[model samples]
Target: MGALQGRIAWVTGAGSGIGQAAAIALAREGATVVLTGRRKEPLQQTAATIKDDGGKAVVRPGDLMKASVVGRIATDIEKAFGRLDILVNNAGLNITERSWRQLKPEGIDLVIEGNLSSAFYCATAVLPMMRRQKGGVLIHTASMAGRVVSPLSGTAYTAAKHAVVAMSHSLNMEECVNGIRSCVVCPGEVATPILDKRPVPVSKEDRAKMVQSEDCGDLIRYVACLPPHVCINEVHITPTWNRGYVAALQQAHVGAGKK
Candidate 1:
């Protein structure tokens, strides 16, 4: 039997990338995964993959940015399963016009809603169920930009991610007593579709060297499977290549030669 056999897990943004990968991994471990996203088609695809692998999945499509939608989803899950064992709050987005000059008020709102507010809504919605059950796990997908300031991720995205990190930690501080553990995963340069929103075009070679979605899925699965007594507060992960570090070194060399 898989470690998570009989557990019920809900994964947001499960249509593609890290969210989709995490859902499949959790289901593989025997969890009945609930997949949610803005679109229905992608969530259906994820469910199909899990079903083919002999795992179970349910597609619950919604715009998580709206509290009403999140509330309804939570109610439905509680009614159907009576308990929630895990929540992967992985839905988020980045804007192409991320810099200060290009950042519009609307863009800021959209990024904040997608990355931070939605997570808050989901976490709160499940906390009651988890508390009643006396144990649960909340894994948040943050970014390295959440740990370190980065121009590449743009102002709004960076700020929103940093807030996500803080929010996850706050959950741990308060909810640990309830036997609920919250973990925030900070990963660098994942080669997901969101990369297409980058202001600068990323080369195929660079994408190949960056972290993959499956890597994160495995990490999340490990976190979820740990003993109930053990809680992973945070994790910082990066590709072995370390593209940001390499770029900084090359820029320093160019500046020295010009001087």
Candidate 2:
């Protein structure tokens, strides 16, 4: 449980939701956490909580959608920590179903670039450092929407998440040779501030029926605590009330048939 003690971890989207929770969890286990997100206040808030709990943390605020910033964050981590021990690519984004359907070129670019490409960019940036360090952990946060589309998220999100799945799998294969273990975490609907960014505000009662976010953080801790060679390729977590998102899909399919 305490395996992460004294380790250094970089977690994106750390301003809130799974990213925020997971960052604190990692810190509790002895990891010096680097919290990143577009908002400075929220990221610093997360860092403050960790520091209050006798944990180490720093904040790096930026729009991860920028490729240049991705590289810069990695460089900053290298400069600050000297050696990278863990990389948690936990940032993500989604749009309204209608917006996604409109296929605005910029939206397409943003979703793909932010949620998907950023992982590779950050991972690649850290790979050489990890290789030199002899061993490291790479954990990418993906959505269950990547596993299957749902009423909860839109096409842009699903597309971006699918790319994350593909990229993580490839990373697992490619980085193993360098003593780096890569894995993706596919979480079900989590009740966190990410819901606030949704086109619709998901109600607390409704979110409670979904996955408990602490569970997601625990899984990250589990992955981090595993023995060497025990790379859990992926984790699929969801609410008991939700099953394969069958209801949402059934309605979508039936509605399409009506059209």
Winning model by lDDT: 1
- Backbone clash numbers for all candidates listed: 0, 0
Q: Which parts of model 2 are misplaced by more than 4 Å?
A: 97-100, 150-152, 197-201, 243-259
Screening candidate 2 with a backbone cut-off below 3 angstroms (N, C-alpha, C), the clashing residue pairs are none
Estimate the TM-score of every prediction: 0.98, 0.89
The alpha-carbon lDDT assigned to residue 31 of candidate 1 equals 99
Q: With candidate 2 superimposed using the best TM-score fit, by how many Å does residue 196's alpha carbon deviate from the native?
A: 3.3
- The CA lDDT at 8 in model 1 is 98
Weakest lDDT window of 10 consecutive positions for candidate 1 = 194-203
Report the Cα RMSD per candidate: 1.0, 3.7
lDDT of 2 by residue, 1-259 (tens): 4678878999998988888888988999999999999999999999999999999999988888777897898899989889888888988776554253566877777778889888778888888899998788888899887898755577777878988988888877887887788888988888876677677777878888888767887788778767767788888888887744667789999999999
Return the clash pairs for model 1, or none.
none
